[model samples]
Target: MIGPATPEGTLFEGRVHHMSIERLLAFSGGPFTLNHWPARNLHIDPEKAAEAGFPAPVASGLQAQGHIIRLLIDLLGDAWSRTGSFHSRFRRPVFAGDSIQAKARLAARRAEAGVTQYTFDVWCERHDGEIAVVGTAACTVHEPNPGVQAA
Candidate 1:
């Protein structure tokens, strides 16, 4: 059986990491969504979404990004916060009440001098298996733990 991922796992090419937003956990940013803060918007009000042509409120793209970041942190620990960079494109609308999963596969890992660089192909998949977001993320570490070399 596979074990939980940890920084000590020697992050290797092809390893996978993930996080999820269950159907029960989907949320509207609401007050935090300053554009429509505390008021009706495409993200917090279904009626507003209909006005704009969508059937229901859509979650922010950044929310999906947040889940991907959480997966990275779980897999890479603090190294992700200090040196990670991410770029993403929203492919399909993530509507309210949808269940989605943010997944990452380590696509590259290299070490030279005192630096170790890691890259991942990341995506968010809707419950029905359609991709909702896609991106690449990378992190660089200086003088990483000797035990953490890529396997």
Candidate 2:
């Protein structure tokens, strides 16, 4: 679970939640080759990807977005779930074999109407040091529930 609200200017980062070739394929809807003709770029076949101009099968942009959101959730917990908002742009394709890392720097915080709202500059970088996605996220910090005890 997430702890107290992070101070402004704090940096938070996390490694990729691995998405293997099998997992990517599964996420795109079960097994098939480019020859068998499943959805475009959904299979792991390199030849098909090369035909499509990518060196290999690329992971879906949604998957990369999910990773970014997961990073925010890891840092802010329910604050993110209940009030967080994200806007992201995919700058580059993330291939199936690449590892990803998410990082965020808290840019600002303010208290209003019983909640502390936070703004963060967030990005996900590929293992090769290229930023694959970039965005801003906002989450509101609410008071802990006194009636619910921690486990």
TM-score for each predicted model, relative to the true structure:
0.72, 0.78
Regions more than 4 Å wrong, model 2: 1-5, 30-47, 145-151
The numbered model that scores best in TM-score is: 2
Error of 1 at 120 (Å): 0.4
lDDT of each: 0.66, 0.74
Using lDDT as the measure, the top candidate is 2
Give one digit per residue, the lDDT tens place, for model 2 in 50-98.
Answer: 8888888888887877877877777677666678899899898888788
Error of 1 at 74 (Å): 0.9
> Per-residue lDDT tens digits of candidate 1, residues 1-151?
1112233223222222222323212344444546744555677677888999998777777776777887777656667778889999989987777777777777776777867787888888877788888999888766544223223
Any idea what lDDT model 2 has? 0.74
Give the residue spans of candidate 1 off by over 4 A.
Answer: 1-37, 143-151
